[model samples]
Target chain A: MTADHLRREEWAVTLPSLGWLLALFAAPTLLVFAVSFRPADPYGGIGAGWTLATLREMARTPLGPVIARTVRLSALTTAICLALAIPCGTCLARVAPRRQAVLLLLVVVPFWTSFLIRVFAWRMLLHPEGPLKRVLVTVGLADPHTQLLYSEPAVLLVMVYTFLPFAILPIYAAAEKFDLALLEAARDLGAGPWGAFVKVFLPGIGRGVLTATLMVLIPALGSYVIPDLVGGPGQDMLGNRIAQRAFSDRNLPQASALSAALTLAALAPMALAALVQRRPPALEAAARKEAA
Target chain B: MRRSRWPPVVTAAVLVFLWLPIAVLAANSFNRSRFGSSWEGLSLRWYRALLADADTWRALRNSLVVGVGATLTSLALGTSAAVALHRHRSRLQRLHYALVYSPLVVPDLLMGMSLLVLFVALGADLGLGTVYLAHTTFCVSYVAMVVLARLQDFDPSILEAARDLGAGRWTVVRRVLLPLLAPGLAAAGLLAFTLSIDDFVITFFVAGPGATTLPVRVYSMIKHSRNLPAINALSVLMLAATFTAVRASRRLLQEDRP
Candidate 1:
């Protein structure tokens, strides 16, 4: 086929998908950007007036606690997921090929279930009078009547549970490509364990770390259900607030602005991941060449 | 060689943490206690109740319709995009990937919120149709991502060889490319179906009255009522379906891998 013919074919193949995305995905996002700047109607519909007031109103709204709590929880969740997933990924990468597949299957199978149900399951398990609570009491971790549900810790636990697979998947993908000999070489060159990890191991898996961070942090920040079912009303996150402003209160403009703010927050990690993901290939290829 | 003991221990512990709640849910589904506080005895009464509820069946029907509709549409769009990206390598492909992946990063709350606003702006009715559209929008990204990954390792010369035999472009795609892509298509289809069925936030915003999905129904049931057994039974059934679909797709993809 001629170059022009292939190019024409490419466009032909791409147009339908791109057009669908542009219409349903991209344009709708732009609409959100536009709608965020519009004034709210008296009754709940959007009005004609255009202003920056809605955007600025995000500052004055009492969203500080929610934002702070969300960031704190997301940070903790991301940290825990990273801590756990890194080892899991390392284990996965080091295992035999058959064992690796089985382990991965085990990791991924639970995620196939409804995430909502999984979260609800956590609610049941953490119920003040549930079996898990009984187990905890019997194990002497807590006295009977100790409330495990409707608490901050429950939200954090569920978030970590829900997002651990996300962290582990990318980390495992990156770690699979890792050259284990590099770690040995670093250690043989008189580097201490911590030094080997910091200089060689960490940099080798930087892309995975970045990907896992973005995967865990963004979703953890936007999570509402965990908090709603487990954390109670006082523990509302950015997601709950946005849902409330839009659905319950019928306040679209403020909700739009909050959504925009959330998009900004989530975008930060995505931007970092994109940068990390792009740069690693060039660096790795160069390293491979040098080693050869 | 010194073996690190912590990795397996930590991994197993994390796995336990992950499955413990699910195990609780599964076990509680069979427990007779209304609160699942204690296992009085094993019973299928909750399952009987779940099976008997008309609303449950209606919601299940809606979820199935939505799942099927979204998956089919997403497979079409996502496969095309994957094929295009695979065939056309350029700087623009990076932009395509970013655009394709944008929905994955965009919080569901925002994705749903924005679409709700857009629908209102367009004066579109919020119903099963809107839910399908919203599900399709996000699901396409997942499908595209999965298919694109599969295509990365695909050999392009097969298409050329087929074309060299005087096959038309459509014939080459149909006779050769589609066969190779079948596993990816199946995986993407199942992924999209599962995602659509489990989606709550997006459906919550787009669904109008009389269009409740299973997740939305379960949420309301949890909020409005205290009975946990029926919901547990329903969740277990959904879980079983999801597990079967995922296993089937994984088997397909695994068998095709070189």
Candidate 2:
């Protein structure tokens, strides 16, 4: 009714969520950073005091390969998703407006289904005696003994499959807003279709491309289930190791250290983008726009 | 200008790639086979087995309980946060915005691990309660985002008009605001429920030995290759539910549009 009342109402509304998040989200994130410095007790608990021992141990541990592998796999997944999504998004954008909603729903239905189920489906499809393997073998594309399950390529393939919709939606959102006349103009200026696509269409949807990359890349980096289910021992990513430390080794501090490293790695590109352009990364901006 | 065939070809290929595995899984759910490597014949034996499995039922129950609890909690918190965020502009709200937004971007693994550490530090037991807490943490952000989007098209004058007509603040909210926000809230609630129920990574970390959600149960079943056909059956059911919920949410949102 009044300014004072409105301000009070705002605070009243804000405080509950603010307190909840602070207690749960903020405090826990800070706790991860704090615990990363603490010692791991032998009995699956944090030790009494703080130490750099965990960080020092992490430095000496052979995490380089895992980190490198995580980045490589995630980057590859993002690249592949982008390549596939560009055309898919372009096609969706060009579809009849009435059919666009149905097609988008088709894309989203698989995404909204249980993530584990999708990953499990991949496991089934890639099974040694599965139909896919049998078909490939029959076509002389694979040795009969060769398994499609449990390999780096398997992980990459599933990751691309899993995150492809994420990439496509954002690109489609951007492409839908793009002007078609620009392409015609580019063609009129003597550019071939390929040149017009590369020169005009790509730049036109640059924000969407950036958004799609981050959407795919960030989740791929933090992926645990994909690599664990479909990947071999040699394909352990940072996520797998982080889970192993917490669940198997019961090393809380080490797990915290790993999680902290992952949090930084995930946020690094976003922060870097923000710094370079003096604006929030397109992912966050796109999210806000989507929310609005 | 002539239309290139590349877009349609690529689109079809990608769409098939997306749906093939799901279609295979759905088809195999009816397969009267043990391994699900090949189809024997169309039958509902796996579905019957899934119904007979007590463990799957228990996990599904746990998922429903957590899902409903998290959805209700996040709806209240997220709706309030969204309304406050939409109306207010200040440094504190900006900080609140960051708090709300960060959870959306933070990796589930990190969020799960961090919460596990926090629970361990606080000596809280890992169980469904912890999973509920963990889920509400992220669900609130999603709910807020959805509500905020709904609020973007809202007209503040309607509220002013109600107030001028001698409606009290609560009356205005109850009579006008809540009705207008109902669609957004329902969509947000459905989304929250779906996310909470389908969540595995976070629930995996926070859930005690006794507190297995459906996804976690499905994960172990997949790992052990136990009753593979039954998992297919359950996957099909869950997928059906997800699709229905998504469609319902879309319909609600579309109906809300002028």
| DockQ, all models | 0.75, 0.83
CA lDDT scores, all candidates in order:
0.86, 0.92
> What does the interface RMSD come to for each candidate?
1.2, 0.9
Q: What is the C-alpha lDDT profile of model 1 across A1-292, one tens digit per residue?
A: 6989877887887887788888888888778778888998877778887998887777777778999999999999999999999888989999999888888988988877788888888878888778788988999999986888888888999899999999999999988999998988887899887788788888988879888898889988889878988897688999999888887778788888888788888888877776767887798799899999
* Per-model TM-score versus the true fold: 0.95, 0.96
List ranges where model 2 is wrong by over 4 Å: A1-3, A276-292
List where candidate 1 sits over 4 angstroms from the true fold: A1-4, A274-292
Best by lDDT: 2
Model 2, span B23-140: residue lDDT tens: 9999999888876777788899999999999998899899999999999999999999999899999888999999999998887898999999999999998998999999999999
Candidate 1 backbone collisions, by pair: none
Looking at model 2 chain B, report the run of 10 residues with the lowest lDDT sum: B32-41
lDDT of 1 at B129: 94
Candidate 2 residue lDDT tens string, A1-292: 5999878888998999999999999999989999999999888989998799999999999888999999999999999999999999999999997888888998999999899999999998999878899999899999999978999999999999999999999999999999999999999999999999998899789889888888888888999999999999999999999999999999999999999999989998787655645543675688799999
